[model samples]
Target: MNGPALFYDKAAFRKAGLQPPATWKELRQAAAKPTGGRSYGLALSAVATEEGSWQYVPFLGSGGDLEQLDSAESVSALTYWTSLLHDGSA
Candidate 1:
């Protein structure tokens, strides 16, 4: 089956001279670059408890379990997201 897709702004990518990220690592690399001084590099929403949980699903899934968040995969996923915030990318 096909997975979900992230539709990026073609104009922003062109202005940034960046190609769409083919992997999570590539996304991390580009997440810190602003798009033409107009929009943020990335946008995330975790407004409240429910929404936060919903938004966290992907990161939790990357680690494999909702209960065991101490797993290496879980840590990696959280750390990656934290980096985005810390690096001012999101």
Candidate 2:
């Protein structure tokens, strides 16, 4: 119900010479910053139902089609989702 906002550790980003990611791809890239051996770039919840689907909307909007789940768009969306989880970027 609220709008999107970036809640980052500003000091850390500043020390690392980084900025808030402006897009999904930027987010993916930003999520790769080295934590000097102990932290992740991002975190997310993983529950079933509306919350889970809500988390997917961005990717779906980035490249997906509800009417044709098998289309390249949908596949790209799904792939991004899987990669995020697999790579621990979300």
Candidate 3:
């Protein structure tokens, strides 16, 4: 089945001296570490369409609910995404 997944370059991680991230915070930190020279730490689908929304489901699923779009968890998820962009991690 098609799904959201993360792909990493083992060599890149080794070169950056990073272990695979185990948590959202870790992922955020790691995302910036290997970013440079036309490389990005994470690539997200931000297009305004179903494909874009699909790419976000997994992240939101971790702490947010579509049913409660205004809930704290939802806000947090969005905030996290914003942080990633702001920090040049995505």
Top candidate on lDDT is 3
By TM-score, the candidates rank as 3, 1, 2
**Model 2 vs. true fold: TM:** 0.74
Q: Rank by lDDT, highest first.
A: 3, 2, 1
Evaluate residue 54 in candidate 3 and report its C-alpha lDDT on the 0 to 100 scale: 76
| TM-score winner | 3
Per-residue lDDT of model 3, residues 1-90, tens digit only = 339888888999999999998889899988999887788898888999877887776778677987887899998998898888888888
Q: 2 or 3, which is superior by lDDT? A: 3
Q: TM-score for every candidate vs. truth?
A: 0.78, 0.74, 0.89
Q: State each model's C-alpha RMSD to the native.
A: 3.2, 2.5, 1.6
lDDT scores in order: 0.71, 0.72, 0.85
Off by over 4 Å in 1: 1-5, 35-38
Question: Could you tell me how far off, in angstroms, the CA of residue 65 lies in candidate 1 after the best superposition?
Answer: 2.1
Cα-based RMSD of candidate 2? 2.5
Q: For residues 1-90, could you state the per-residue lDDT of candidate 2 as single tens digits? A: 523445788887787788888887877787777333457777655678776566666567766876788999999988877787678665
Residue-wise lDDT of candidate 1 within 1-90, one digit each (tens)? Answer: 223336678887888889998777888777767623555787766577765656656655554566777788888888887888777777
Better of 1 and 3 by TM-score: 3
Clashes of 2: 0
